[model samples]
Target: MVVVVGKEEVVVVNFGNSKAVLCRGGLAVPLSSDLKGERADEKGRCDDEAVVGRTINWNACHLPPLSTTSRSLGGEYRKQYIIMEPEVTVMKRTEQSDDFLIIATNSLWNVVGDKTACEVVKRYCVNGESGRLMSSDGSSTAAAASEAATALAVLAMAKGSRHNISIIVVQLK
Candidate 1:
């Protein structure tokens, strides 16, 4: 989730593996972290809980066999292990330097790095004088964002990502 604070800062909140990335001056900045059971902190949290038959890692290749993500929206039975909490980040926006924001699922991030994803989006969403994506054909920011999202999804697939991919590109500049 995203909230713009007074037109100067953006508040990003995320749970699970989904992530948020901000592009500033052509640089990629991460706004969230992937919450998985294999993570030390996450594993400790589960280990600390006083629950009987708590399984942290299972025989399967996927760590946190109960769920891939340590946090999520719903899982009544798995509530003992999974959480609904989120990580929040507030970043001041640079009107002249900040370019755009990308929110995508783990599928894209599993195969793509933050810098590469930002570069791919920036390549498609070049801004104009109006600070919105514009082309000689009068393409709008929305169209450019869609194109960027599509490009990222395609890249993830080409990189051998088998999971479902979802991406949202928002022009900030």
Candidate 2:
């Protein structure tokens, strides 16, 4: 997650199973949260073999259950196990040449890792393109990032990925 707050814009990105709150003036302002478990699989089931008696290794690195509302919204009946606390990156420019960019994704980390994502962002930055922009208010930065991530996912899909893909992108100026 990268958050950039420049003289002209503010950007934010979310990619983990945790919640991220970007507050203003010391107030708690939630920038992004895994309220819907959108990153989780729709058909993935909890690994029953992972459970030892009644204790389950919920922290296991394995894929979570499709119905598991461990970290999402609209699961009032189930206990909140986790929150979408996104890894945040903030860049605030004090000069007039301030700009913001963000990218996000939900595909397998093995396909397009964070280093690749950062490289993509850097490439976009050096390429000098204007269409790929981040949000100014920092509200849509994640969305912008998601778009970039989606594009990467599509590329990965072309390469071959037998799974669903979702991404968000946001840019500000």
Please report the candidate that would top TM-score against the real structure: 1
Query: lDDT (CA) for every model shown?
Result: 0.76, 0.40
**Candidate 2 ranges with C-alpha deviation above 4 Å:** 1-69, 83-100, 108-110, 121-150, 158-162
For residues 1-173, could you state the per-residue lDDT of candidate 1 as single tens digits?
Answer: 44354478889877776888888888999988877665677766656647423544553113234566767775576676667778788888778888888899888988999999998887775455655654335568788888889989999999988776989988886
How close to the true structure is residue 128 of candidate 2, measured as C-alpha lDDT? 38
TM per candidate: 0.84, 0.41
Best by lDDT: 1
| Deviation from native of the Cα of residue 15 in model 2, angstroms | 9.3
Instruction: Report the lDDT tens digits of candidate 2 across residue range 110-137.
Output: 3555445445543333233443344334
Give the lowest summed-lDDT range of ten residues in model 1: 56-65
Query: What shift in Å separates residue 52 of candidate 2 from its native position after superposition?
Result: 12
Q: How accurate is candidate 1 locally (lDDT)?
A: 0.76
